[model samples]
Target: MTASLPVATQQDGTYPRPQLMRGAWHPLDGQWDFAFRDDPREAPAGVDFDDTIVVPFPPESPASGIGDTGYHLVAWYRRRVTAEDIADAGAAGTGARVMIRFGAVDWAADVWVNGTHLGSHTGGQTPFSIDATDVLDRDGDNELVVRAVDDPHDVAVLRGKQDWLEEPHAIWYHRTTGIWQPVWLEVVPETHVESLAWSSDVPNGSVTLELTLDARPADELDATVELRIAGELLARTNVRLLDRTTEITLHLARQRNGQQYEHLLWNPETPRLIDATITLGRGASEVDAVSSYLGLRSVQATDRRFLLNGRPLYLRSVLAQNYWPESHLAAPDAAALRREVQLILDLGFNAARVHQKAEDPRFLYWADRLGLMIWGETASAYEFSERAIAALTTEWMALVRRDRSHPSIVAWVPLNESWGVQHIASDARQQAFSRSISDLTRSLDGSRPVISNDGWEHAGSDIWTVHDYEADPEILAHRYGSTAAITELFDGFGPAGRRISVGQQDGGQPVMLTEFGGVSYIDQDVEGAWGYSSASDAQDFARRVGGIVGAVRAATPLAGFCYTQLTDTGQETNGLVRADRSPKIPIEDLRRIIAGD
Candidate 1:
């Protein structure tokens, strides 16, 4: 069945980078020349493009207008760039450096600007850029070509839930090939802000900001960083840029105009954000400036509870795959993204465990703005190999660096359900690798909690998370009621049976039922529709959901619970909402069950 378009179309000219905004920019969206080939050889100069695909949408998606689900190992895209695009870029006496940024492209991507070879990027889920200033022809139209290659079956590649078979089965869906996010061009000065790292100390009421510049000090340049709240300047500092990076701390607890100020903390209820402006100047002349914002919040976990901003917080979350029937991984528009978050909130969910895929930055931006918590997870590969390990680690690090600044992301989940490291319980090296990754994440950012391997055998995890699909609520409550019940439940277990609870039991750590209640409901008689358990009708689905969630909530020691899913995708007909986002059960009924009202 073909899916209908969303109510609102995505704005064509909306800047892709919302965290850091600059004035001079152009979107490279819309239609682009596309061609499919079997080999990865360079495109022949005279070859004619046979098809057109929409930018930011994968070829396999209906939104791309090219519903080619067949695997194409190599795909090429070409677009024309006119000189008029960069006319107003170099206006401030500073030489303009034009950079073409790709929000995300699947697997591997190589680029050429005016036939000049630019760089290539490997990961499919993170953003990357190519400096096009040197190669673009300012007088005439320039040719831009991109070649992307993806092999979904390759165990080394992190394909997430994209099935390798011709048709999707089980939890896996159709593959997303080529570009899946918006492409745009940005104009910046010779030396610009490359990235910003943030950390907040809630108890001390202060925040530290680390600014990384594109280049080292070319001359004696002074950098000024200012923090403001609702247009009232809180603090400002100036530093001499002698290196590539500088760090500044802004103490929120201070006296301003002989009056004391109280620290405003960010929570799911009130996600307060403070604005920031960074300026680089040579002597008295301003060379570069950028605007950004940050939320002052802290996430910590004690033995028995999860703490947000130093207060005990309970998570009512849903598993969000972030997929659509028409758009596959990409949301049809920004409005659809907002609608999804609103639906989650309306259904009484405060957080989302983003399943498998690393969601779009725009979605995260909304989460930060709308006061929703997120459990950031990496897309895990199925095979265990050196190549897979390296690829997963590299991409996981990139994901961390790309998203660590967002205050909404309270936890980092590196692995889920032992997807890639199946032998982690028996293999020492695999266990060590898991510990290394957990340590690495903590070292990179010590502010948030890290779950090395979620769901079952966890070696190094701050929060002990488990996934149980037992449909009976009585059994679930009996099993998780007390510390003795958990101990006796897994006593004298072998390696295979101990997959659910490996290592020594720790009651001090926060316990969470991360995955449960995948009760299915089929409105129509469709083949291959499945879930953990099937319900006959809407009332039956609601009853089963209430039983499962109510049971988990009655287990008082449990910190939180994440329902199976937010919406249906592919054959997984267990979501609260249908594949097209229509509610399978009444919203109020589901909310009452989820909120334990």
Candidate 2:
């Protein structure tokens, strides 16, 4: 019920698709009739629409009005689409196609429009759509129904931090079964731009634009793209669209004029985004247009260093669960997503290692504009099997394709702590799975470093990372202060008693203490809340964080370190900030310690 807000009262505001934005789209994020049953074999004939829930928020979330956390395999939702809904999308009156886009639905989703089967989608973390023009009841109201299926006990599914047990336990929390992201409608011209893929070449002062259209182009069809930086025209070109997809490179005028291209580069210090506009037309009149942007940035994993813009950049990062008490996995609002990014940077961390979640695009939008770096990660199935491979592989690929253009994302962690492949250290099949994911990620996006498995047991990785929670500063300093010690440790069982590498250490890759300093501190009583270490007071907490973080910073051979976490989630009280995002200590003091100053 609290999903929609007036267009004002916001900054850069939230839009489902930030990259390809058109002004004529309509939001479908109000209310929907919901049920928890499978009585309907196909569409519209549901057993009952007993409850009304807010769109986008999952039924397990309090914002959804159901707040049901129990295990359920299926959830049904119903709503009515009216003429005003189509009219509000101003572009649909003529030869336009109305597409209903669902930002995400957990596990599996079968949708229907006006009782017509629109087919099903099998992923939980990526966007899918249905061209509903054919099935729309233009003369009257149209009924929209969705049936979502998610098995809580299915270990082969990508559950992320969602607990499969009856109650939340360990680091896992409650499950988000169905309809956890946005649903909206956009009216596109019959020959509109379907997708945009952007990549920047800082060295060449140019950007490569790959565009896909909704249909085959006519003989005289033309597409024009404009690039700008700081309101100054950077590049513009009009290319002929002979096929449905076309690629064009736009070289910036600043680079062509022998000006300093450094000012145009995007980094944490000055996050410069080159704005762009794409237009499709037959001759003079514009058929379709959308505004987009890309950042001129580069990231690399050099031996013993992490490079940003070809400069050695030490990553000060924190693991982000990104869960809210009221909203669970789906962010509470657009402003909340922006606030989380600001909080991470305010604590002196340059990057967020978003653990177990492929973050919302709105979060990436703010990070791209605010100069915060992100290590994008996704959920892993608990077991290694054929089902696990299919589910994880399909979802992960779609996720990568959906997010590869963002400038803030510098790395990808396909698997973490060997969660899905627990026996990867020895099992050949499991090891192959890890390698395949790494290889697949590189094939899709080779611009960012791919960590096959983050903590230990790296089958194929561009960075050698390990998670060690040793509380004593001196012990951690001595353990990782030298390269010889790290190499020796990699030869045997690591801090977690898992093999660090399969055969070789993949020398020349940067080494980092990726997870450490999980010092728990809380002023209030909360049972079962714990961390790797505990502190009694705010001063004690600061001292513990400074000690642990400083130890890793003092390791001369290591590239960087990511502290335990950012905010507390459920029973994990190891956050610099509380569950409600309140700082435990003075913000300045915490920033000083995290910055290793």
For this target, which candidate reaches the highest lDDT against the unseen true structure?
A: 2
Task: List lDDT for all candidates, in order.
Answer: 0.81, 0.86
Q: What TM-score would you give candidate 1 relative to the actual structure?
A: 0.94
Per-residue lDDT of 124-163 in model 2, one digit per residue for the tens? Answer: 8889988899989766899888899888888998988999
Clashes of 2: 0
Clashing pairs for model 2 are none
What's each prediction's TM-score? 0.94, 0.96
Clashes of each: 1, 0
Which runs of model 1 end up more than 4 angstroms from their true locations?
1-13, 44-47, 88-93, 254-263, 489-498, 501-507
All models, RMSD in angstroms? 5.0, 3.2
- Report how far off residue 381 is in candidate 2 (Å): 0.5
- lDDT minimum window of 10 residues, candidate 1: 1-10
